[model samples]
Target: MADQEETHTNGSGDNQDSPATAKKSGRTSLLDSGEDFEVLDDVDEDVDDDLPPLEDAGGHKKKSSGEEESAQAEGANVTELSAPQEEWLDVLGNGLLKKKVLEPGSGPDSKPQRGQNVTVRLRSSLADGTVVEEEPNLSFTLGDGDVIQALDLTVQLMETGEKALVETDAKYAYGALGSVTPAVPPDTALTLELELLSASDAPDLELMSPAERIQLASQKRERGNVYYQRGDYAFAVNSYSIALQITEASSKVDISPQEEEELLDVKVKCLNNMAAAQLKLDHYDAALRSCVSVLAHQPDNIKALFRKGKVLALQGEYAEAIRILKRALKLEPSSKTIHAELSKLVKKHSEQKGAEQAMYKKMLGNPADSSAQKRQAKTSWGVSWKWLFGATAVAIGGVALSVVIAARN
Candidate 1:
């Protein structure tokens, strides 16, 4: 899918070779801004050695075997004083993910909720112990598509101060297209060490600054793009929907003109991308609504127009589809994608019309066939009438002859 952007006037002081210019020059880049783009090429060798021993909520550190024995001697339950279990628990029961708790956390009754902000320290490595990603402290909204599916699912199962070693299948992590930043190979599994630092309710959108909302919304859109690339259309749709919600909420708050424009641009992009994802899921009506919403704000948005046309065609509204596609083509006369879509829609429209005509002919008898049958029936009736008249004449003639003979006698 092509990335959509609004045309912005460069001020005299602005850099002529801005990142925005570079992004606009290509159709492949899903992100509108370069501020949050990340690459994880550098590996911290001391990452393993730097972290202190895992500790629970009450500052109780994980104990060694001897320490465990000492704690048991002090009347602590032997089971509770024992080291974290080495036995791996299957998290999903599908063999895709397996977890072994290294340090059990306190507060068994509390865990991160959906829509809450979660912070964790993460270290991911390949099966051979080559670290691909290491973050001292990473924070994201739980269940917001901020992280990989595996991390999201794994963290929700954790409590504050919990430490676990998780084995992840590629499908739950990066799928086939692995990270370019981390230099991970395609379809490679990884070992993750995660420590749930904390979880708290997400900040209200109204309470956040306009810039914060824009940044968060953009992050969500980028996440959605990742899901889209992985062919996870349902997840992609959810991410985009969340982005749209953030932008819509941001619009209500009093904001500067520049912020408003930026928010609108992001909103348009999210709506367009969401429509594309929804279309992939065969959600024709929802896709149509998304496209329509984009057009209402940005009438010349070629992507939105093209997608709307596609959804309409899928719904068998060929005439409207053609009109929408033609408009899109007109707006971007040089866009090969728009031209190709329009051509396809036209072909489909013609085929659909032909099919409809054939179906009507079957439902209502064909005019030519009807006329021929009528003529055949008319000719048959004429022959029968002529035969009846001839028989009557013969009978009448016989009767008259008999009467004449009687008079002569």
Candidate 2:
């Protein structure tokens, strides 16, 4: 499932907080725009961190980097620690919070030891307590190893409707992993709290209704995209496969055929990506199967048709290659890559389409060579960095203002 996530903008700068405005009587004051914050004092002090080196409040060590920003929407708290709170702070020297356990569960792969899945929502912070990353809501098979070890440990200890703070060094989590994280140090340690809102021990049903399966599959697809961007194409293919399976199982959505077509369109693209990535890994049969799956959903898809032609060419079915390639070219005349591929096939099968195959093959070009996907990177990529700077400024200013207000204490 594709997610239309909103883009974040921070004007011209990032990491700085929005300007703070104040009014005294009829006069307004805007001195060096910054953040205004109230220091929170009543925090739970009883927690665990066996490491003796931590210097947290009451000697709690932090498991991850970055102060937890108080995100009211996600109900996830972000706070920075002085030398004191670092005990519970498990910030990886890089930025990401190594996936920590949100609940203790069975074990990786739903092993009798790992545990079951859990539903949760988290607003995350990178180093220095920046709330730039957040999963407003998410579901994981918990101990099934869908998340890091710390989150699983924390999740298992939590009862239904229970929430607690849990942290861990990145060693047991994702370490200096660069392919997925933009600036994270490879294998860096991480820390976070598990606020359990709900826990259920339901059976894992693979035969659920198509609609429900579609929803679950979509979540997998989104997670796959996040990982794919991190250059984990294999995971992306698996996630897209799950989505295609759900769609293939059923086409009726209790709606009109027009609506069904729209849903199928989504599935077609999922199948296309699955095939593309699988081919990159040299899994020809699997790639061909995925392309066929897309045609079953929507025969008019030029991309899938083109991909199918490529698969045929790989199998040395030059005659079929020329036919499918020609069809794809008719639909997308402006595609430079498609023209390149058919040129070769037309030569392999001189009599594939009698007289026209040669002409069409030249027009289709060499179907063998694939062009890079023409997709625009998320607009937020640029905006989010600027926002980060702006937010940081505001946050620092807010901290200073709080220090001034609480000096009397």
Q: Write the per-residue lDDT of candidate 2 for residues 285-306, one digit (tens) a residue.
A: 8989988987886786666677
Off by over 4 Å in 1: 4-85, 250-253, 358-365, 369-409
lDDT of 1 by residue, 112-139 (tens): 7778999999999999999999998999
Each model's lDDT: 0.74, 0.51
Compared with the true structure, model 2 gives a TM-score of 0.47
- lDDT accuracy of residue 42 in candidate 2: 31
Give the range where candidate 1 is weakest over 10 consecutive residues by summed lDDT: 9-18
